[model samples]
Target: MLSSFFTISLKPVTRPIFLYLLLLAVCTGGTTGELKAADNKALAADRKKVDSLNQLAFDQKRFDVAQALNNLFNAENLAIAGNYQKGLATTLFYEAGIYHQNGYDKKALATYYKSKLIFESLKDTLNMAIVNKEIATSLYASGQSGEAIQLYDESLTVFTKLKDQRQIANINNSLGLVQLDQRKYDIAEASFNKALALSIEIRHQYGEKKAYYNLGLLEEKRNNFARSEEYYLKSLAIDRLMNDKFGAALNHLQLASIHQQQGRSDASITDAKEAYSSAYVVSAYNLMKNASARVIDVYRQKNDILRASEWQDSLVNVLNMQIANEKEYALNFIEVIKNQNAKNTNAEKDLEKQKQVQKEQLLIITVGTFILIIVAVLAVLALVNYQRQRFFGKELKQKNEIIEKNSASLDQLNKEISHQNLLLEEDNKTKNKLLSIISHDLRTPLVNTKGVLNLVNQGMVPPEEADRLLQLLETQYLGTTSLLDNLLFWIKGQMDGKEDDKVKVGLHQLIKVLEEEHRMPLMKKKITLRNLVDRDLAIVTEKEMMRIVCRNLISNAVKFTNENGTIDITSRLGDDHCLYLAVKDNGIGMTKEAIEKVNAKQYYNTTGTSYEKGSGFGLMLCRDLISKAGGELIVESEPGKGSTFTIRMPLS
Candidate 1:
């Protein structure tokens, strides 16, 4: 019957025919039932044909062969009747490759491992190598770079022994990328250069381009800007020639960074926009988003407010487009899987009850037709969706590009405005200083002149009176000149941005000098002046600035105090390397609001009890000078109560 069947079916039966015939005899008691025998023979023959087709399809990268082989393996009675373990393993490996090609990495990984174990048991070295490479690739795709590197290394060793230079270069490129992630830049650069050299030697342009791209990234990390730029341009030229959109986009991004560092804002904006556009074409979301953001930053830094705002809006649109594309991809992939599974399940049930003879012959043809139809429909739908997404993404990207261009102009405007504001502030400070000098320095001499003139008008004395008046006039002129000199010195120091002359001065000595200067004025008001400054206390400050601060505080106290009122001057060492100097007076004090205003460093002025007029600049100058000497000026006053002014300075 086997011989007749081979003749009728026009198929050559190979090894295991006798064993299959013996099994048939045992099951049918040596029956010459040609139908059952032919059915068994036909089932084995179909399996062999499926295995042959599967091998051819895998070699040709045709996934439909896998579907046909899978259908044959699912034949329940036939699978059980014959030992199909070898055939099953082969089908599983091919199926895994198909899934991997389709980007179903996790599923491909699971299938690859299952086939790997089976092949290991069967001692299939060639299939094992193939499976390992696929598994490593899946690992890399899933972000397990460490594990992927190890696997790729192992596979590379095997392929190297097999004299597969193409696969070796491929593995080398992948390993270099892993090294880059580990921040082993030098090693990565060496690896990529070696790979590139090998690829050129072998005339593999694709591998050469990939190696150059990686080398460009390594040089960028090393801050070898000129070398990096050269490599990136080379990569870009190659990628463009090869029509590699993703690589081109990445190259543009690197070029943009170079422009940014060189302060070529317009060129940077142009490169960034091109990068974003190219990245969008390839769906490189991270690169696109980053380039968009860089354009925004450049515009903002240049003070181009309009351009900055425009790019910001463009960034939002790019983000939205990326999200929409991801959603569409996920949805399309899920829908394809669902329809395939439903068709597979229904086909399995239909084949289960078929008589073995008919089932074996019909199953392959039936399942192949069904799968082909489904795949065709899915491919069409996916193509349509891809077109839609790409169209919208391009539109959104163009809008963003326009925004980036406008932002560049706005940034320039902002820089101009900031420069103008700085100039305005400097001018205001100069005007304030001039007004202070005129109001405070000139008033003293004018008052003294008025007093002397009143005495002269009375004509109370003779030639001696005229001499006394001249002396008074000379004293007032000297006072006014001293005030003017101090004012001019402060103004020049401020204009030149000169820091104060810090030195260590004894607190006791400083207080005594100030007291001696104010003794006559204090005596005129009949105010008692007490000094409790520690002789041993010392402070680091600008000596002359400190003298001005102390002189102003004591002079104001003397002027404000009532007749017979007491004024106390004291210093104490405080914790944390500080010295506190206090000048307290029993005089007409200030209201709470007035004290607050004074403490807040706001302008506050009032005529003294002795009618001593002030510029209101005295305390402000004191505050400013004290702050420059690393000290603080604080005022404590209450309505109708005494006021205390304290100076806190860092101790030597």
Candidate 2:
């Protein structure tokens, strides 16, 4: 029977539970290469059984979702108990597909993500691509076409890289559907045509059928009914050849609509009855209901009340059966909800534990620093007493002798006190810099990312806005990563005694990275960013430190620059065997006082021309890093003019 089924596998199972069954049957029919190494026959047998159950459930999914869901839950539990990751992911993916088909879009997205994460962790790129494609489909249906297309492109890229022609064809077909809905007729046709070509080349009848069907829809939208009818007929031929009753039902219903629109009552009725019979045999109640309604409408139009009445009774029965099936599905899907809730609870607990550990570590460090400061102050007081005693008189010679006897101890304490003072100052600066960066730059982007993600998850972001937000999200993500890198480098330099790892650093490449990181800001202000540094310009310095300093300078430029302003980054050889790298912005310049503070290595707060906030500690951090790297920072600015922040680093 299985061999016979395989022989007729000309039709591709697309967007239906039947596809899952076909995949599961093929996968479980033999020892999967993924698990063939398992020496335990019993374990393999168990996995096979689990796969079989999934296949059986999928076979019943559309007609009896309740029973199918129950089977899926059992499969999920067994996979969990056996630690069968691939099986578990497969079950979750199928379950999500069911939820999507049932109109539970949000639930489906969540489940799809869970499956995707598992596939990612497993390094199963193919499965991850598959899940992403499904998620995009759901997004498209939910009217989030922009986000959907983004996801579709991401999936396509992966599929393309893997050279998976089948998935590639499928993605093209899906993209065509989205473009069709958007009424981009030419683009849609191109997409469908590409999918068709790929499918025909691969002999993927299922993909071919879908491409034809979508092409039909596109023509129908263009009011080219004759062309549409031809496409539907081709698709219908495939459905019949594949013995896909559900597909036949769909084709017949479309044909009925076209015939009715053409004012051919008899033809419409014939097509409608064929659709109803096809759907009835497969227990596809929804299609049956639609087809029956069409037949009833045609008969009533012809004043055949008896015929309409007969069809009306059939419609009522279909509706009742559909409702019953829905209720059953709802009852079983609750188990899935409970499982998801439990997982969420566990995740929340883990997050809370992590937060608690971070808080405790911070508290410990803060308390220890406070006690060290107190000890340092006490030592300073004793040193002052010793100085006064030495200056006072010979009357305190007895005390003088004791002090002299403890002179080595006092000297050691003095050295420690000096060291502590330096450390305390550096620690204080680090604390201020970290606090400012976290409160201002880091926090905003993270919050924005979270807000955008939440909006996406809730399906509330509009297509145009979502596109903009996606760009913002990417910019914010990269900026956040760069900022964190800077922080880590600075922190490491402060804590570690290792010298700067000097290397040949390309100034042009460095500036280019900063340009990309600040692209959003530059674009927002319509600023022209010119990287005038020579492509081969190189400097021997700590790459990360140089990166941090340069990032701050470019960021400040973008901040201060007004709309339609220009910012130029230029590098030249200095007279002192050093490189002069200047970031010059022609917009709102800094005041003389601000320039003085910057040149003097002092921290001061200032806002951008657009009221963009800054940490005020960036320049200070840059100055410290540059000074350690045998470099100097110079600031030149005046009110209503442009500003230039230049770094002079030794050429060696």
Q: Which predicted model would earn the best TM-score?
A: 2
Q: Provide TM-scores for the models.
A: 0.41, 0.45
Instruction: Give the Cα error of residue 50 in candidate 1, in Å.
Output: 8.9
Per-residue alpha-carbon lDDT of candidate 2 for residues 414-500, written as tens digits (9 for 90 to 100): 999999999899779768878978887888888888889899878897888888889878866765776677677767877758767
Tens digit of per-residue lDDT, candidate 1, span 1-652: 9567545443323224445545754765545476678868887896776577566656645324334334433432233334466676776777677678767788889989988998899887666777787788788888888788888888888878888777777778878888988899878887888788888889887888888878888888888878888888888988898887778888888888988887888988988899988887767787888998989989987999898898898889888988897677567556655655776676556555545656765686567656654554355457658989899999999999999888987898899999999989967965886687686569757977887777777875677887877765764564465466557656755775676667888878988997876766676678988888888877777778778888878877877889899999998877777888999998888788887777766666788897866656667677877786778998888656788999988776
- At residue 554, give the lDDT of candidate 2: 89
CA RMSD of all predictions: 33.3, 31.5
lDDT measured at residue 400 in model 2 versus the true structure, 0 to 100: 83
Model 2 sits at a Cα RMSD from the real structure of 31.5
Question: Model 1 residue 150 lDDT?
Answer: 82
CA-lDDT, candidates in order: 0.76, 0.85
Off by over 4 Å in 1: 1-108, 118-127, 137-146, 283-286, 347-652
